[model samples]
Target: MFSTILVPIDLAEPESSHRALDAAFHMAHEYNSDVHVMTVVPDFGMSIVGGYFPEGFEQKALDGTRQRLDEYLEGAVPDNVDVKGHVAHGSIYEEILRVAKEVGADVIVMASHRPAMRDYLIGPNAARVVRHATQSVLVVRD
Candidate 1:
């Protein structure tokens, strides 16, 4: 039985995210596992985009995202499940895998949206995570 489950969500996509969270919650209940819910913030440190935002934008974004994650958990997470929220910066797929390893997740549960042309060329974060993750992954399709 799994001891820890990770669910990575995109806050912009509520429907798919909730579906993935539900899957994680179900598994957590069955296995008595702790749930790690994470969302990645794009790294804006690159020279081009960095100039656009004013100073402290990264900290502000992180604070807002952390609040949103906490609010989401209050409503969505079950009372009995042990849940922790994490906010990471940089490439989504890489941060997810890094967090999964850091937290020692036994399985990763995440959603996959309908693929667009760009996904074929670059692949979606879900696909990349699936390919790179050492732990088991459950892709909940939307």
Candidate 2:
């Protein structure tokens, strides 16, 4: 049982995270806990100093992510269940950890959708968080 459950989502592959969300919800419902669902947009830093996006590109991504999260909650999160949605820009592991501490989360539930190239070298973000986080982590491996 947990007081707060953190569910991390990858906007590109939403389906991959369904299982993790289910687990988080199950635990939340059973314990009457709060759920904090979050997604981190990888910072596509500017090409050089004093560089900026092409006319609202950054806002477009943020807006899109928020809208998508809204739609996802409308479809996936039950109406009676209380959940908070967060969209942030940063390194995935760091953002997740920050949210966890900010909320004083008892546990974090996330999904792993197979490894790509970079994961093999430095390990996946989830792996890093599991090793580093002060609270508990439940990584739902596909």
Candidate 3:
């Protein structure tokens, strides 16, 4: 019985998270749980990378991501489901974990794509979240 479900999705590749979102919704409906959907805006990896962009670019990106997250939930989430949206900046897995703790999520439902050789070398965000999260995680394959 999950009372709070947190789903982290990549808006750029929303199709990747469809199954996970559906699974979270199903669980939410079953347990009358609140759903927290989140997306992360990755920071420019280096200070030089930041210098390449104009001032306030990060803020603009964050604002735009928040808007997109809200629009995504408006269309995807059912009216009956109690859902909240979060937009974060920084490492995807870290932001997800932070939000999960912030929201007191009981479980996290997220999507994982088929592994590629590169993923084996450098783990994907889902793998990182699975390994690091304090909460239970259910990874839906895409």
The estimated TM-scores of all candidates read 0.95, 0.89, 0.96
Worst 10 residues of 3 by lDDT: 73-82
In candidate 1, the residue pairs with backbone N, CA or C atoms under 3 Å apart (3 or more residues apart, or in different chains) clash, namely none
lDDT of 1 by residue, 58-121 (tens): 8999999999988988888878888999999899999999999999998999999989999999
> Candidate 1 — what's its lDDT?
0.92
lDDT of 2 by residue, 38-118 (tens): 998877655562155576777788889999988887788877888899998877899999999988899999998578888
> What TM-score quantifies how close candidate 2 is to the native fold?
0.89
How many residue pairs clash (N, CA or C atoms closer than 3 angstroms) in each of the candidate models, in the order given? 0, 0, 0
- Prediction 1 TM-score vs. true: 0.95
True lDDT of residue 94, candidate 1 = 97
TM-score-wise, the better of 1 and 3 is: 3
Of candidates 2 and 1, the better by TM-score: 1
> How many angstroms is residue 59 displaced in model 3 relative to the true structure, after the best TM-score fit?
0.7
- Relative to the unseen true structure, what is the C-alpha lDDT of residue 97 in candidate 1, on a scale of 0 to 100? 98
* Top TM-score model: 3
Higher-ranked by lDDT: 2 or 3: 3
Candidate 3 CA-lDDT value: 0.92
Global lDDT of each model? 0.92, 0.86, 0.92
